[model samples]
Target: MDIRQLKYFVAIVDAGSLSKAAQKLYIAQPSLSQQMAALEDELETQLLLRSARGVKPTTAGHALYQRARAILRQMEQLRADVREDGGSESGMVAVGLPTTIAAVLAVPLFEHVRKHFPGIRLQIFESMSGYISEMLPDGRLDLAILFRDSETHGMSVIPAFDEELYVFGHAGLKLRKTATTCPLSALAGVPLVTPGTVNNLRLLIERTFLREEVELHIVGDIDSLPALMAIAHGGSACTILPASAMLHRAENARPPMRRIVAPDMSRPASVCWSHALPVSAAALAVRKAMVGLIGQLHADGRWPGITLRPPPDAATLEDTSGSV
Candidate 1:
């Protein structure tokens, strides 16, 4: 019930040991243990069960830890928003994105945020769109830059821009599909290198292959287009990725790239976040900055064959104005 209690529990869960958690929190091990025991007694359920693997959360502990983490994050966010000059853009932002998008976008976005809002803290992690969606509903992330629609439930979707997916291959390989469109059947004999099927792009690719009864011979399974490009361009295999992916890159150390299309394949980038709660000033500024940057990327013809979704908050300018 108390913030201290919750803090200690969360620390233990993260540290995976009473001793380690105490060390991190700068509290005595016995004192931390006492606090945790008091908490479990108050709840009338064991929050942790010690094991050789380290401290483990029981079924109840698992659920409680999840809620506790969110509560603590929200509390910290609130604290940051209430301090002196809280009205100013300041505090931390934990951002999540899928591997490919993060690989391309996170660095630039980080740089922009730092230049404009130096007080804001930036933490980045690359996962799939699905994982980002799941994390957003909780306070795990202040915002998520992703694709494949919003699964954050109560969150709002700010469509940034869309990019056309192109199949790429080495020069020596005989591409069965025409340059105009990548046919599903064209993947039949090709040794494919794609992301895990669970990934959005891979799921789309898999569905296309299934429709045509094409068995994509996957020679490598990767998580990002950059990695895929590095491997595929070496003539080890072939893969499909957004055309924008290669726009800013240097010539591959191995071979060159040729576009692939089966007649249709496309995807878009989306900035997702919760609408139910007020965001910290830092989070708000970053979101606006990202939208402008994406808009700029589109305008520059960097996103050549893409279309951007509508900017966020149609009725509300809210002292925010800028464009790329």
Candidate 2:
């Protein structure tokens, strides 16, 4: 019915109990319940189903919960814009990164915001690319670094870079120390641990292997990057991922890494934001900062195994300016 009621409803849904929501909102439980009742009355529909266990949103409540979150985000962005107009950019900007990319970029991005955009608060979510992809379109994340194959309808996607996949494992693995690359056929019988099929990187690996007529002996499915690396380092199974995934470790301590070749495989990373939502000044600033940081990292060779994609405008200009 109103913004306050919507907020209360969302809190209730998230907390799953009136008492819990009341505690979170710092209001009385009865007051919260009354607000919910008023909201349901105004809408002429039951929003939530109550029970001894807890509460769950009805179908309409689920729908309103999604729209309420987006509306709340917009309202916050409106406030941020007003503050930006007063000469300082200040607001929360949520950015999502896949686990592997987070290993290389998270801290640098956090420090960059702290130094350059003092008033802007950075909320970075590091998870599976699949999860991050789900958040970006619903206003839960202002921006995200997602793979090219991600579901991206109604979103503006900018190519960031292409990173080559590599085979990594402990010294006990069958990999040759003298070789810098491993042929796709070499891994046909190798025990491997990889992210599940839902992950873009995993999907890419699967498609590549299938097309090349190579069979993969996937021993385990690990969505967590750290756990996958640990399994590989312990000689449980070799894992395939970009070199950037190991950037957090000391160079000397890194596991054996060999680029996948004989038809090298790579995945394109893209910066994405919802086209339906109005991006705030703070979000825009963070996006620029992230792009510039990626460029610098690539230029300095700090982030390796990646070829930066040129800006869309540059690509367009080159296309139109080609010699006849």
Candidate 3:
């Protein structure tokens, strides 16, 4: 019936339980239940299905949830615009980063936003790139760094950089030492742990192998970065990933890494946001900050195996520029 009720409903659906949502919203359970009841009554239809296991949204509830999220985002953007009218930017900006990219960029990006745009609150969601890509279209994320090859319909995408993939494993794996890069053929018989089939990186690797007529012996299909790294560290199997994925590890603690040759491999990363939603000043500020920090990192030699894309054209730059 009201924005407050919609917020409560969204919270309940997200938390999957009234008690949990109530705790998160700092409200009494009975009060939350009553509010939901009132909303359902006003709607003239049942919205949620309750059971011992918890709650799930009905068809009508799901439809309302999507619209409510969009409405809330618009309200937030309006508030941000009003706040920035006085020459100060303030609002929440949600950014999505893949696990590998997060290892290299999350901390620096967070610090940069806090130091430069002190009035803006940054929310960094770290997950698999595939999962992160799914959140951008629904107004859940203000911006995301995703693979350039991702499904980006109805979104604005800015190419950021190209990152080379490498083979990583412990010394015990007995991977032949290469002066600079290892041939893709050398890994034909090596046992490997990689992401699942649905992952973009996995698909790329598969296509490359198929095109090159090389045999890829995958021993495990693990989508988690840490788990894959652990399997490689244990000398059980090697993994292929961007060098940025190991940026958080100390040099001595890092596994051996070698660039893949015999037709080098790399993937492009991009900054993306939905075209259907209004981007707030806070979000724009964060996006600019992210791009600048990425360039700085490449220039400082902090980010490895990555080539920064050239600057945007005059027209593109003009489109992205704002008062923030």
Candidate 4:
């Protein structure tokens, strides 16, 4: 019925629970419930179905939810765009960040965006690459930093940087220095520690190894990168990492990333956005900032100094002129 009600409804769908959404919105559970009920009542549509586990969007609920997001985004943008004629770029930029990348760059990215584009508010959602990719063309995301760039109908993919994936392991193992650049076959009998089921990166690694017929002795499956690093630090297991992934060493980690590289083993990071919307001035600023920042990071010896993937191929991104 109103933005307030629509927000509550969206939050409920996002959190998948009335109580959780209430908590996130900083409102009482009953109040949030009343708003949603009122909304459904006004629409004369069953927007959601309550369940023991959580709320599920009914067929009608799903449709309204999609419409609600677009409406909200457009309303927000309308206000921002109206204010843009004063020579400042202003709007809400929803950024979709891959988990590990979010952990490493969220703060810095925020700082950069805030410093330059002071009027542009950034909302970051740290999620799996798959989820971000799904959201991009749906008016949910303005941009994303992700790992995979599988072809999407109305989206443009830009291969941003290339970093060497590393093989990480315990201090006690006989890790050879040459393993960093060793063939994927070197991992055939190698024991490793990897992320658990929820981590998409781990899933990708598992599938890649499976396809390559590489049998890795997975020593442990854990969710937290810090914990994985701890086990690796404690000389308890061997794991894989990006040469750019900085793990605090309680002990020396080796063969120090030499074991993870192979022709097909390298994963390129990407920046993507939906081709659905017209590129706003603020989005263009963010895009230029991202390219500059990646290069700057490389020069700082961060992430083993990733090289921007060249253009047009699956290994590259179509370079935008930033002329918009």
RMSD of each: 4.8, 5.3, 3.2, 4.2
Which scores better on TM-score, 2 or 4?
2
Could you tell me how far off, in angstroms, the CA of residue 21 lies in candidate 1 after the best superposition? 5.0
* Residues 80-103 of candidate 3: C-alpha lDDT, one tens digit per residue: 667678436678888999999998
Which candidate should be chosen as best, given TM-score against the real structure? 3
TM-score-sorted candidate list, best first: 3, 2, 4, 1
Pairs with steric clashes in candidate 4: 168-239, 169-238, 179-258, 179-259, 180-257, 180-258, 180-259, 181-258, 244-303
Clashes of each: 8, 0, 0, 9
Worst 10 residues of 1 by lDDT: 315-324
Q: Candidate 3 has what TM-score? A: 0.87
Q: Could you estimate the TM-score for every candidate?
A: 0.78, 0.85, 0.87, 0.80
TM-score result, candidate 4: 0.80
Judged by whole-model lDDT over C-alpha atoms, candidate 1 comes out at: 0.71
Scored by lDDT, model 2 comes in at: 0.82
Q: Give the residue spans of candidate 1 off by over 4 A.
A: 12-35, 48-59, 128-131, 150-152, 171-173, 176-182, 224-226, 247-249, 254-258, 275-278, 302-305, 316-324
In angstroms, give how far residue 316 of model 3 lies from its true place: 2.8
lDDT (Cα atoms) of all candidates against the true structure: 0.71, 0.82, 0.82, 0.69
In angstroms, the error of model 4 at 24 is 3.9
Clashes of 3: 0
